[model samples]
Target: MTPKEYLEIVHIINELKDTPRHCVTKNNRIESVAEHSWRIAMMALLLEDTFSDVDIDKVMRMCVIHDLGECFTGDIPVFLKTDDDRRQEAKLLDEFLDTLPEQLSHNMRALYQEMEACQSREAKIFKALDKLEAVIQHNEAPISSWEEHEYDLQRHYAFDVVAFSSWLSELREEILQETEYKIQQEQ
Candidate 1:
């Protein structure tokens, strides 16, 4: 990569350095998007053992790249998206991806679309863990920033998370349960 390309990537990473996720660690501290991405990738690798039908590499790649667009769009919470807002976000993500070299841009756009489509097993697992990580982070963090976004339990249930939606649909419950358990242990 040229210095210019490297600097752009660095700038994106820097922009996200302070952006907090919906979850806090067990110690009640905020985690950055970079940390969240790293954990999600780890989750994809760990869950690969159970998802025999999924392409683990593809799933991991999807998880790692899923939020790259957020580097530009910022972390727009799922519940906050109106129809027009979503359409604009989609356009922004595509346009941002297009800024890359031809092949790289194509690949990133395709991956983003595949993730949104969630038609494949890999996409399914990635989406599931994405929610899971957010809830987990919220539990560990000091603030209920996620709740402030109005992403209540019902909305989460209504959201379509593709392949594992039926099975992993209780992300809201999982987050609350895990948070409760952690709080109890601390006491």
Candidate 2:
């Protein structure tokens, strides 16, 4: 890649650090998209043993790149996203991908597409880790920071993790229980 191309990619990637995770409660300090991506990538690596048939490398890549569009569109909270938001995000992702060399852009685009499609084992695992990380972060945040409605939404997200893998489902339950206990202790 040319020096200009390399710098362009770096600039776009750097935007992730400034993009806050929008689903998280606004009362608490929010995590950047970059931070969320790092946690999801780590979770994918750590939890790979639970899935015997997934491609760990692809899962990691998907976790990291899944939100690249957010660097452009900003993080749209899942509950608030409309069809227009989805279209906008896809357009922004394509523009971001266009900044890279053809091969790299193609690969990253494919990874993002696979994650969205949620068809392959690796994609499914990555999707589970994405939701799992959100719940984990929410649990770590101050209990008082979350409104009742936010808690309900997060709990439902935890349950949705079950659709990907049984091991992740069990972990989700454990996280929910732990969060409940922590809230009780705070009371």
Candidate 3:
């Protein structure tokens, strides 16, 4: 790929840095989509030992690329995102990917397909981490930083996503414990 092409592609993805998600940071700052992606990538790296059966490297890639669509549509909270919202993100991201250098575009397209399928082990792990990361961040942020409905979202959001693996389920429970403690403290 030419240097010009590479930089241009990154410049487009740079939109994610400005895209904000619903999760707040511990400092009471709204976290960007890029921050969310970075944590899931970190979560994938940290899980390498625990999920030895899967291709952790690919999981990491999926984690990084899963939310690229947010660069275009910005973030829609899981509770509010509709099917059309998802379609628009995918469409815009697909258009952006097509403009990338050939192999990089191919790789990203494959990762997006794998993530959408959510059937392969790598895909499942990435998906679970994606959901869990938001919950983890919410738990870290002050109680007043959260919207009232998020308490319920934190309790039940990732249950099904992580149900395929006991380790993931256990991690979810640990996050749930933290959420319970936070709620108790607030009460």
Top candidate when judged by TM-score against the true structure: 3
| lDDT tens readout by residue for model 3, 2-117 | 88977887898899999998888999998999999998999899988998888999998998888888888999998899999988988898899888878888989988888889
Better model by lDDT: candidate 1 vs candidate 2: 2
Q: Write model 1 residue lDDT over 1-187, tens digit each, in one string.
A: 6789968867765756677654557576666677888888998888666676778988888888777656666666666657776777578767766667788778877888788887777777888788777665555555434454433542344245533555555545565566667556656
- Residues 1-187, candidate 2: write the lDDT tens digits: 9998788788878999999875454357777999899888998888667775778989999988888888888988777899999999899889877868899989997888787788888887888888788778878777776767776765677576466667777888898887778677888
Please count the clashing residue pairs in each candidate, in the order shown.
7, 0, 0
Where model 3 places Cα greater than 4 Å from the true spot, the runs are none
Best candidate (score: lDDT):
3
Task: Tell me how far the alpha carbon of residue 9 in candidate 3 is from the true structure, in angstroms, after superposition.
Answer: 0.9
Pairs of colliding residues, candidate 3: none
- Can you list the residue pairs that collide in candidate 2? none
Q: Model 2 scores what on Cα lDDT?
A: 0.81
Please give the distance, in angstroms, between residue 4's alpha carbon in candidate 3 and its true position after superposition. 1.0
Candidate order by lDDT, highest to lowest? 3, 2, 1
lDDT agreement with native, every candidate: 0.68, 0.81, 0.91
Instruction: Kindly indicate the candidate among 2 and 3 with the higher TM-score.
Output: 3
